[model samples]
Target: MRLVATPFQRRPAPAFAIAVFLAITAFANPASAATPTQTQPRASVMTVAAHSQIDTRISGLHTRLQITAAQEELWQKVAQVMRDNAGTMDSLRQARTSQANNMSAVDDLKSYGQIADAHADGIRKLTPAFQALYDSMSDVQKKNADLIFQTDHHHAAKKG
Candidate 1:
């Protein structure tokens, strides 16, 4: 018997999903205050918040995956990518903040493109390490890993 692995049939590996989620979070929440004139130390505050969120997500995924000692090296590589991606995004965000008032429309679009490119690059770097870890996983571990990446509604439906 022969089997084929199709894109639709393949679940996102946990590390990749976490990286993607972090990238999405970075873009979705712009460093803007609720009020235009409201003054707060937004840059530092947002940077800390972003790091905290990334740390929490990584911890949750690590626990859910139950990563074995054998997989630790692969996990470390994936974790580093997540941290690097977060730092890059945070730097880009801070740059945007400093130039928010002075940026032209073309410059703004270029900045957005830079952020998008960084996310894509991060995912590209994350995939191989995550695939190695996924390959090391047993059947039960693979199922658990897959579940970690499922949407809330899908997970709930599966549970019910």
Candidate 2:
């Protein structure tokens, strides 16, 4: 007998799902391999809300890390990196999805590798900005930041 892992489970996640700096990852659920359900084709109609009922704010990050005014600039850089990483991962995932039917085993793995490569690229860009922000934090703030990143309990909980 053989066990087969789902694509989402098999693919590398650190640089991909962790949302650049892991903030979005912290706030949201990781995507799954389950086919999305659609009642209509091609998203024929979409609604834009002036104010989302669901709070998508990462202001919780500022609260959690107790970011001071002095730290806001550095924090913004970290936030931007997270957004950029998410965009890159989304593009890679969409490309993989588009080609899913015709992909050979090697092609599938290579496509997954593209995501891993992008993740590594994201981290390389993320590290310096994060390090700078981390450096300027007070001891208490640093401890909180360390706790958030080290365990990433929220992401873990979702996976389980």
Candidate 3:
């Protein structure tokens, strides 16, 4: 008997791969992982704290990219998507924290799936806006943007 992979099996493998990649990318950056801690009573409070950090990061990127007035609209779109993704993750985290004690293993996995889906959705929305901004960038700005978006492991290895 020959073993064969079904279409469903093949389909889920790529989706699972993407979910793993997004999970790693989302959690790898300390700044990006600004979801409310156990001590934080409200995600809103954590969001307020995170806003400044996000602004600082975005501002640095803006300067590095040397964004012009023409590119500001697309930049704002990308920035807004980043903010939305953070808020969605924070909300998901808060919901999971509140319900964790009552949730079954399957339920907990479902909650994680929701968070992962949100991360994927955020990337979907961000890509077009980011592509627009990237297309408008000068050669130097494009290089800076590439560096800014590169994985931490790659960046660190290069630096070291």
Candidate with best lDDT:
1
Summed backbone clashes in each candidate are 0, 0, 0
Q: How high is the CA lDDT of each candidate model?
A: 0.57, 0.53, 0.52
lDDT of 1: 0.57
Q: Write the per-residue lDDT of candidate 2 for residues 56-145, one digit (tens) a residue.
A: 324556677888899999988876665555554554544455556666666665555555555666678789988998999989889998
The sequence of per-residue lDDT tens digits that candidate 3 reaches over residues 20-115 is 111111211121223425322232533564556555656766787789999999889777666555554555545555555666555545555555
TM per candidate? 0.66, 0.66, 0.63
Query: Which ranking of candidates, highest TM-score first?
Result: 2, 1, 3
lDDT of 1 by residue, 5-51 (tens): 23222122122323443342122112232222232122234467667
How much is 45 displaced in model 3, in angstroms? 9.4
Best of the two (1, 3) by lDDT: 1
Q: Show where candidate 3 strays beyond 4 Å.
A: 1-46, 151-160
Output the better candidate (2/3) by lDDT: 2
Q: How far out, in Å, is residue 134 in model 2?
A: 0.6
List candidate 2 stretches off by more than 4 Å.
1-16, 23-58, 153-160
Candidate 1: which pairs clash? none
